[model samples]
Target: MDPGQGKKAVLNRSCRTNTSFLSFLCVYTIMKWALLSVWDKTGIVDLAQALIQHNFSIMSSGGTGTALAGAGIPFTEVSRYTGFPEMMDGRVKTLHPKVHGGLLGRRQIDDAIMAKYGINRIGLLVVNLYPFERMSRESLPLEKLIEYIDVGGPAMIRAAAKNFKDVAVVVDPSDYPEVVKTLSSNVGFSHEQRLIFAKKAFARTAAYDAAISNHLSNLDNTFPPILTLQFTNGRMLRYGENPHQQAAVYGTTGIAGAEPLQGKQMSYNNYLDVNAGTALLAEFEEPTAVIVKHNNPCGVSVGTDILEAYLSARDVDPVSAYGSVVSLNREVDKKLAEAIDSTFVEVVAAPSFTRDAVEAMRKKENMRVLILPERNTSDEVRTIDGGVLVQRTPAYQENWQVITDRDPTTDEMSALRIAWKVCKHTKSNTIIFADQKRTLGIGAGQMSRVDSAKIAIEKACAPLAGSAVASDAFLPFPDTLEVAAKAGATALVQPGGSIRDDEVIKAANRLNVAMVFTGVRYFRH
Candidate 1:
């Protein structure tokens, strides 16, 4: 045989013998990759080290790369891997096809495509967007806030999340430990775990976009053509208004005030009742106590002493006050705690609690104790079928116009003012009867104003003589006025914008009831 022929034969034989080995190497070699590009560096070092221990090639960009290098954890720069430097002031770092292809590659379905493009599979993705919400709240310029809006971060997150069947995407640092545990378990992330992460990833991006949209809209108009609201789930309540309905509480800003100190979890009704009590208590600067039941103020009072205020408020209608949420504007002491303990209250909230009060509260293990911060005023949002109504919080009864011939006495005026403030928080067609700055009877959520008046009188059970009455809105007809007069209400306060304002005033004058028009309507529903 010729030498050249012999060499060719030998080479062909060698290739045939190694064919199976090459196929096995291509199909079975375990290659794991983790891409970490995060604005938050929390738990990144430990995660990177764990990935390195599992033989994962860690790829990072910008600050994340710097952090890994400082921590002595080996990582490959994303720019280096993609062979493209970050451009556009570091905005174009990870937008390349190489990065996305690695994240989106399907190991079983798209292996040929990935192999053709020299795309490596990325098994893990850890990314968090820029703090748009935090920066928007700061006094930064609009241009600065716009710059903080993330572009590439959300893109990578969505891409990874789209391929969640094969790729594990983590946006919250709190999930780092679970991710590390799964990777170390040798079985890797299950499909269910990946799906959960993907759901959270989508929600994170949605909330981010909503915040940006709302901030931009606020600059142009208070009532935008299309309203967008973003809320973070604050708590999952034990139940909704009813036990059978599923419920969770979401807040636009967060659960700022109303921090629960002890006791059972809050229910949806409990939250509504607490909000009603707090809103009513906010209207008074003095030591005030408000007892709210079923989203209505059943009792309210203001006094020099906090204990006295609570006792007086509770005494108005102890039957309706049972299982109510009680809120106070002052610190709760041992005496007030003992008094509250006497009742079967659902929740007790105050600005502060003395040591003795906290100790006394421990006796009622099922009663919820909450320490509330000073209330912050924010816009009110109500959801309808497919839309929401946003408006400024109902303004206090600042401008009053006395329509009656007889002006109110000093004590009557004070009581009328308190009743008006409480009426703003009550439901529509509401009537609140009060005297000496204490609520005597409250009838709310009735269909007719006359019924509300009658209910308030019946709830009072005693003669409403000399008590002041507050109507949440205009008296649509004179029947309410007649009912109030017959109930022996000596003074009345209302928004007074009905078509029958003349008739209502005539009835008030005929009954010798001092009526005042606030001009601003507070129709809460």
Candidate 2:
């Protein structure tokens, strides 16, 4: 026998001996290809190294490829593998059929077609979109901002996610360790794991698109034709407003997104009260403290210092301040922390807490302590029967005018301003009675304006004889104004829009009550 013929005969005999072994070899090789193209290069190098250790080949492009090469990791550039040069400033690299076909191709059903097209099956995909949301907030021009909107990344992620049964997709770098762990497992990624990753991947793309849509629409109109909102970083609560309901909190910034630095988990009621308190606290730049209960401002005050503010606020309605969420605009010191901890507070939030202050708070381990940042307001949204309600207020100053014959005194004016700010955050029909430093009494969420005024007078811990009264809306009749005046309120503030405004003003003049009419109404239902 010839030498070459003998070698060929041996190869043919080995192939015929085990057809199952040949099929297994082919399947194993196809399942070891991973494509990683990410805007955030976090943990990519370590993931590539782990994949290499597990005998998987990596394909990458753009910044990801550059990162892998810098790390000395062997990877096939997407441009090289797809036989297509990355054009359009590296935007057209991964949008090719080869990359998507590899991600979307089925294992068994499309095996023949895939072989014919020379498309490799991508068993794993790791991709993250560009920083469109981050850049949209900058002062960049529209053209420059548009460049950060990624095209191919979302496409590949969607394709891989759609075929999650056969392809594993990862959009978050935080999941790299889990992916690596799964690769080392005997069974690899389970079906449940794949499904979870797929769901997260789809959500990521949806949120990215929503951000882009909202930013573009907001450029032209305050309210877009279609409104889109995306809330992430969710935390499950024990229960909602009531024990029978379910609830969760989702946000990335502001009070909605804040987590406790020390203490018990935040409940649904705790979150509502904290959110309300923080919004009210943001109104005063002075050392201010706000305490909220049942989504209403039970006590709010401004003072020369935080300790003084907190003491005045707490004393305004000490009974109602129990188990309330307290928010302070200034840092909490040891003395203020001790004062706050003396009560059964549910949550305490401040811009910062001194080391001694935090240590003092440790005595109340069950009270949540949050480092509250500057509160930012956006368009408010609420749910209705079948749809949602969106409300946006244009930036404007209040048009305040003296509606009564006698103008309010300087002290009364200062107190009226505080009352108006508190009234804007309170529930209507609401009445707020305040002195120069703190709220004396608050009546909120009442059905009748007269009843709210009566309740405010009845609940005052301090004297109402020299306090300023604030009504959230225009009094339809003079009955509410008369009630406030009869309760010893020296001055009053309300939006003057009712048809009986003249009658109310006359009643105020007759009762010797100083009244101011702010053109803007603050009905916070």
Among all candidates shown, the one with the greatest TM-score: 2
lDDT by residue (tens digit), candidate 1, 338-413: 9999999999999899999999999999899988766667787888997777778544545798998999999899
lDDT agreement with native, every candidate: 0.85, 0.88
For residue 191, what is the lDDT in candidate 1? 95
Candidate 2 CA-lDDT value: 0.88
In order of appearance, the predictions have TM-scores of 0.86, 0.92
lDDT of residue 74 for candidate 2: 81
The residue pairs that clash in candidate 2, if any, are none
Each model's RMSD to truth, in Å? 6.3, 4.5
Angstrom error at residue 139, model 2: 4.9
Model 2 agreement with the true structure over 475-518: per-residue lDDT tens digits: 89999878887777889999899998999889988998999999
CA lDDT, candidate 2, residue 423: 97
